[model samples]
Target: LSPADHLVVVRPNYATNIETPKAIGCAISYVDLDFDQGFAIDIEHVKAELRPNTKLISVTCPHNPTGTMMTRADLDALIALAEHHKCRLLVDETYRDLSYGERLPAAASLSPSAISVCSLSKAFGIPGIRIGWLLTRDPQLQETFLAAKEQIGICGSVIDEAIARATLERRDAFLASLLPEMARRRDIVQAWIDGETLVDWVRPQGGVVGFPRLNIDAGFDLDRFYTRLLEEHGAYVGPGHWFEMPKRFFRLGFGWPTEAELRGGLAAISAALRS
Candidate 1:
């Protein structure tokens, strides 16, 4: 395979912390998505990035940090593009169940060209249970992925898998109870942001995270701001610079912390902003 074999990476991606050329790397041509546009993947841009040497195309739904989703039509277009180019499309649907509306169809379910990866992290709130899996119709690719795992071995604890399986068995019930609490926490954070004059963001459509930008025109230096917030207020918010955007943006986790703690953190952040 040529070193130039292009791998199209769609972002603001789930799991990716930033948005610059180096943030993604040269092996993969990064396709930028607009945060203001609900983080939709631009199909035309994706098409333009395709080369005969392109090997893989990857995407995330209920995207991390931004919490945006890929619509069904966009996904359909991606599948078509992959088939047309004879490339593989890797879809990370880790947060798929957390979406706001009818879930988009799994790309792997639609075609052999699509590969879907999922984990028990994020929405399941079980990072400790490091079990994740991929689904693909191609036996050869599946064998390849499994072979790669042998090199990595099964570092995931069996205990973790057992617990994760139980959680999966009760997934619907668990999410039904969890979603309300998460939604409430999200609302609290949104309200706090709305009241604050120093920050703003496009509201996330799904998932536990949101990326909000500090009022940069007001001379906000997010790196320093986050450092002071952590050191002085004992609060943590992910800096946007970590995700390759303007330093004004910071990632805020709404589902990870308890509502009370999230509120307190937001209050601390507001105080820091004022300072």
Candidate 2:
């Protein structure tokens, strides 16, 4: 749809998702998922925010930087709502494959109105290939998306395609080894956050990272605190402002570093706060 139509965006969401849409001049409205409810996005909020001219409703399942998973019931209701409203429901399922243990049903599979976008980068640890795909049952949207892809990249590399194919062929075996380790890392980070007095968070149900609320007061320049944490303390993290969140809320990427490195980094963060 054109930029003239209204779009509803999720707050504290991935920057590109929010900015790219706004950059193109789409009229924007926001629905913030609260941290206290484990970052749950209430359906009533969506109902209240829906407009007669609304063209798109965008959301992420197994949310980025927060690791919150939208319940199946909520997802189904959203699909039905989009159907009733005759608007597109775009669900970014990049992290769906990395769910703690259970398999998740793709939104597109349940409804023709659903648009599902996914990539192997975060889920399978294969970003170098840069392979991603979009799925939709709407022929017109599918045609439009293909046209957009053509304008951007005429095609992809054969070698990368072959590598991706090989990776997927062994997907089960690979994920078998990877998921448990991720769960371990997630737990470690959770335990560490639990012990910290300066921060509180809604632990992730699935996915690799989480957004933790820093206890800094309102009107404080979280940007300055984040800068010092990086420059003077030799610690780096995703500052909340980057996600269009308050300065006191920062993203904690708990799954990437090794156990020892994770512990060390957490200690460094703790030390920085103490100072």
Candidate 3:
């Protein structure tokens, strides 16, 4: 979508989702996910914000940072709203394979106006390949998007394509092995968060990360706290400032580390917090 296009963003969205549109100066409309309700998106609230000039309604699930999944019914409602409003639905399905829940139909399959973008990075565990693909029934938009892509010279190298192809060929094998471990890691994270007196979070349904907020007394600098966690205890986690959320929040990556390492990291964070 262009700068003049009005795009609706689902929050606490991935920063890229929010920033990219703003960088283009799009007339950004936000429908903040009700964070208190496990980050649920309200379809009626989204419809209430729609404008005649709206061009796209963008969303992500299994969502970034929060790792929440949207129900199929919710997706259907969103697609219907997009259709009625004459706007395209843009879905970032980067973590779709990692999500644990009832399956939602590919938005592209459900409607021609929907576009789904996916990459091997999250689920396929081939982020280094730096390759991703898009699906769209709207061939005209597909062509236009490709033209923009072509202008950027962003074509994947041959090796990247080969890796992506092989990964897709063996997708089930990779997922079967990876998913259980991810679930286990998430459990560890949940337990760790539960143990924290001054930290709590919206537990992620599936996917690797959780964004927990530090319930600090007034005068706490989360930026400094994170720095001290790194410098003093060797604990490293992403702060919410990076994602444009309130400074009290921090991201925990449960899926990326080995279980023992993650345990050690969490303990280190606990120690740092206590200090």
Per-residue lDDT of candidate 3, residues 1-275 (tens digit): 67778988887776777888889888988887655787888888889889988998989888887888888898999999999888999899888888776656778889987989889888777799899888999889889889989998866599889888888998889888888888888888889888888888888876788888787888866667788899998879988778667778778888777888999998887777767
RMSD of each: 2.8, 1.6, 1.6
Give the TM-score of each candidate. 0.90, 0.95, 0.94
lDDT score of residue 199 within candidate 3:
81
How far in Å is the alpha carbon of 71 misplaced in model 1? 1.0
Please identify which of the two predictions, 1 or 3, would achieve the higher TM-score against the true structure: 3
On residues 1-275, what C-alpha lDDT tens digit does candidate 2 reach at each position?
56888888877676777778878887888998887777898898987888988888999988987888888899998998899999989899988888985656998988889999998888887899999899898888889999999999999999999999999899899888988999999888878888998888888877788888887667666666677778887778887778877667788886678788888878887777766
Best by TM-score: 2
Query: Best by lDDT, which number?
Result: 2
Model 1 lDDT per residue over 168-228, tens place: 9999998888877777787888899889887787787788898887775655566667788
- List the candidate 1 regions with Cα displacement exceeding 4 Å: 14-26, 154-156
Clashing pairs in 3: none
> How should the candidates be ordered by TM-score, best one leading?
2, 3, 1
* Prediction 3 global C-alpha lDDT: 0.83
Per-structure clash totals for the candidates = 5, 0, 0
Clashes, model 1: 5
* Model 2 residue pairs with clashes: none
Candidate 1, residue 227: lDDT: 82
